[model samples]
Target chain A: MDSKKGMKRREFLKKAGVTAVAASTAFAAPNVHAKTKTYKWKMVTTWPPHFPVLGEGADDLAKWITEMSDGRLKVSVYGAGELVPAMQAFDAVSQGMVEMGHASSYYWAGKSPATQFFSAVPFGMNAQQLNSWIYQGGGQALWDELYAQFNLKPFLSGNTGVQMGGWFNKEIKSLDDIKGLKMRIPGLGGKVIAKAGGTVVLSAGGEVYTNLERGVIDATEWVGPYHDYKMGFYKVAKFYYYPGWHEAGSSTELFVNKSKFESLPADLKAIVESACARANISMLTHFESQNNKYLQKLVNEHHVKLKKFPDDVIEKFRTLSAEVIGEIVEKDPMSKKVYESYSAFKKDITQWAKLSEATFYDMNK
Target chain B: MDSKKGMKRREFLKKAGVTAVAASTAFAAPNVHAKTKTYKWKMVTTWPPHFPVLGEGADDLAKWITEMSDGRLKVSVYGAGELVPAMQAFDAVSQGMVEMGHASSYYWAGKSPATQFFSAVPFGMNAQQLNSWIYQGGGQALWDELYAQFNLKPFLSGNTGVQMGGWFNKEIKSLDDIKGLKMRIPGLGGKVIAKAGGTVVLSAGGEVYTNLERGVIDATEWVGPYHDYKMGFYKVAKFYYYPGWHEAGSSTELFVNKSKFESLPADLKAIVESACARANISMLTHFESQNNKYLQKLVNEHHVKLKKFPDDVIEKFRTLSAEVIGEIVEKDPMSKKVYESYSAFKKDITQWAKLSEATFYDMNK
Candidate 1:
């Protein structure tokens, strides 16, 4: 977490430029196409270096932008703490300290409560529904409108689909079992858990597994199988629960310094947007692919017990989620607006899903 | 379907050139950057001109390619019958009569039975699962290997999430209800329906509604609610069944003539690939958005009844689908290989979904 560990801008830019130029000009060293204007951009993320899915996805985004633009845009990515630290990514991008940033919008909920809708909500739309709202519905415009007030533009760059409920040391058979439980959850999810009488424990990513393992925290939801498997949560937790009711679909946002984004030439601008989108699709697919493979590994080899939250417990959580959302809406006008839009979209999409996706799943099972 | 309706290549190229030149030079008419070398490419699709989602998606892909490449690549899309008839699109692209094509892979199943796996299969993976397989689980590599034999390279371009099962004038109450019923279905779905004792009627898109209205076909499944609503199936059919047991997620492929694709500059090639990925994301979102809105309209305004196939009917269809898929695998070695891979991936992904997405949906409801 030391600032001293941060790579110098000049060093980062040099490496990025050289790597891109070298790859794009593999056929000819002095290719004129490679000589076209090259842009040096820096991206800071809210994930630890080489962190599973989230962090690695940012790295992939930079690489894709560089390769697709044929060296016209050389983007260097800095993991959390490597630049202005994880939580400061928004401010850094807003002040133009970095041209771009990769982080969850909910991390900045304190700045604009409405931003949390961009990340996720308890009982919110799953990844597909969220994408429908954000991309095709009016969610993106509202997201941009909210971010513009802070001098940043946001793109939904990546998602982890529907997250797992959490890994619990003991089975949560009913609502009473959740009363005194301590869990490592963040943002609005933590708030909901706290309201449901569970102790909300905020642990650093590196400490979560040990914290749960040592009974410092009784439960944690890191992500789905692919990520939790890597974090070795199953080593300590016997019960893995489903239906991440807290964060149904966690979307990662790419924040671009608005003025800097505007300054890019038309093609380079398109490169950035297109690359962000490709990264979005890549992350979801990557999550789905790896999670399934690893889920098999975790259960068959690691002997983790896969479980679903009891119906009564889920009912309790759902009720609490509604109350929590209502409170947020009641407190902030922007939150109210975003919540209404999200809720309406969710209602409509759910109807459609019931006829197609939900029905298919029900029948197949 | 007339050949005379097709636009001349030279004329299309001139118009594309003029459009790009005009837009890029709006601020300064003589800007040298606006003069980047342009490669005019033509893409032919299976959908009629201006068809919702499918055809428009192709046009959008062309537009994205044009913008992203900054005049380096100019693509013009021709819908079914514009450049060639609907069934002729694959041949046109493979023979280099056109640079690219947009159509469902199943449309070319006759040429290579394995191609249908790229589209969809009865009771197969949904959009999310399919994306995971194709993009991350080596499906795309296999697809390229298969298509390369025919002088084409394919990219997964668009998806229509889960399709509706079909529209029935009378309720499907049991397995016997399906017997002697005539339904307009296609691909493997038709075979499955036929196995269940339903008369499989193959009707063109334009005539499907009329056929259903006149009882020439007792039921049909065009797509999900969006396209189905557009086709006015709600007017003739009393019950709309769902969980599109047939093609769970229908994906459209973009076929690029291998030689033409290889001839493009590296950046331009990247543009084509990236644009296709964006189109894939866009189509799913657009479908999710529109389907929901239209489903409501279909139910409320048109007074169509939304229904799920009965448990017994679904069970029967499921068994019949397995038989149909088995027959395909038995008949074609290539199909057997593809099916094995798909089935294995589906089994794994289904396990993961059961834990996360499926469990979530189950509890939320």
Candidate 2:
């Protein structure tokens, strides 16, 4: 390196004389290759634009990819409804309405029901453990296998870290208080809530605030403290709870149409994958970091009282969630296959986390 | 707390009747209360794990310390060789020589220098830019950061990334000539030599290869595949080379000393950071996922001609590498910052690396 050699590599280049733009530009720019190629792709998203974390994550992905490839591959990212209502992104991408999509699999439960296992399951894997299950533990390969049936190659693109329980219109005093509450819940948690005697509804972020404000829904969970505060849910409901069990560690994805994806040249394909990989890690920490600042603002600035869900309520949800998950296993073959593997891995990882992470966390200095 | 709602937060545990863990085994459970505990600390790193990415990264005041206690505490990690032999890790922890040590930092860049930057700096970035610059510019914080740092805290850890073209052995090739030149390489890309020009030497996979291989370091650069490979150069050299600059995105990290880390209250130290954010994109993937496969078959299944460097050969290395990079920077500060930032961070990171890491890897990535 620079430590030993007498002459610098940059100096050697100065003597030879090449330019900076050349350095930043893709090496293959103005390709002298006999054949020139360009790729045009459409990407649909689950989040709206410039919404900071989630939405911006998608926009940034598209922008960076275009720049990196030097216009060889062009991708236009359409926000939630710009392509399809946010929840519909999965099917649209799967059906090849677009070349790609940025979405959370939990939103597609109505389509396959089994897809929720990939995104999150109540009492499921945490982000790290989930990632391990997916990437290192045959989850991604199986996900690919499942999506292939739908003409899709799914990539884990984003994560919401562990989410917060929804904002509620009334105090969730006890397990018996949930009679006919309508909550915007999705994925496995929705089923668990339904089991716990709440009417589960599904809607996008842009709609949640209005619904909660209008009393159309008594409660709603939309990401974490940062976005929830932004949506002003605290103004409508003060009972914000901890431990989001529904979509814990929710992951977003760039679901590429298999046909279109299979056709790209090697370099461009690599570019797409790398870009998404960056997004995946970036999205998680982005939320974790930003949410801390925003949560303080929510309580200190907005006067939202943070409260833990009463134990009986949580206990009931846990019990019902377990039953709901079991029922899911009895109903879906894919779910069963996934759960079997998922739970097996979860057990192994839980043992480590309990011993390593749990112990350290419990005994304070 | 898991205790029932009727119980007070403190006595809540007894009321719940859940068994309490004995003090001797306390470092293994999750904390129930958050945000009000202080943690004293020590963290050991692999960078000597003493400095920079290997040490400093581990040592940077715990980001969570402020958030957890509303700003009452901080913990630090030490570098390798600070308390024990760079390689004698099992003994160090078992004996509690230090609370924790930074993770791998190249599984002990002492074990192998060529792979030291697996955490960072081939043609890497300065520290600040690494924290933000490289990641947004297509370098995710965790790419090889944690895996190369230790095995945990991927994003929290960082490598300088590809180092400068390392010191070398005799060289000079039409680029294709670096066949059968035995050199020590660490991490994954050490596996990619056919294109760059070299026959890699694989020993027990540690830092020792750098100097010991000096008699054999034909024209080595381990990091830039350029620099690190250079560091492992052949002894009594004839030709020197350039390029290996591709690892401009390498990283390094501070492995937190484990016990010190464990002693922190929940939230006071969230060791898991925002770094693990995932993306749907992939990169150098062809090399990572595909070419690696072919390169293997060629090297193993078919046994293509493996090579070493020849002097007329490195003449080209010294030539094209400069041409390739100078063309990259030309005169732009953005390019310069990109370059300067990487260089600067590398310099700062190295200060610590030199005392701890350099001593280890220089002797041992």
On DockQ, the leading prediction is 1
Cα lDDT of model 2 overall? 0.53
Candidate 2 residue-pair clash tally: 147
Q: Write the per-residue lDDT of candidate 2 for residues A212-325, one digit (tens) a residue.
A: 888889998777886777788888897777667565578877889998888776545655765675677677656654565567677778888777677567667768878988
Winner by lDDT: 1
Query: After TM-score superposition, what is the CA distance of residue A353 in candidate 1 from its true location, in Å?
Result: 1.1
Query: Model 1, A95-115: lDDT tens per residue?
Result: 988889999899998898899
Runs in model 1 deviating more than 4 A are A1-35, B1-37
TM-score of each: 0.89, 0.52
- Would you list the C-alpha lDDT of every candidate in the order shown? 0.83, 0.53
Angstrom error of the Cα, residue B341, model 1: value is: 0.4
Kindly report the docking quality category of candidate 2. Answer: incorrect
**DockQ per candidate:** 0.35, 0.02
Model 1 deviation from native, Cα RMSD in Å: 7.1
Residue-level lDDT tens digits of model 1 in B1-365:
11221234224435544333233233211222322445678999999887998889999998988877775577888988888999999999889888899999998878988898999898889998999999998798889989999999999899999998889989888888889999998888888888888899988888998999899999888888898887788888899887788888999989999988887667777788888889999999999999978888888888888887887777788788899888888998878887888888888888778767786677555
* Best candidate (score: TM-score): 1
Query: Candidate 2 regions off by >4 Å?
Result: A1-35, A363-365, B1-365
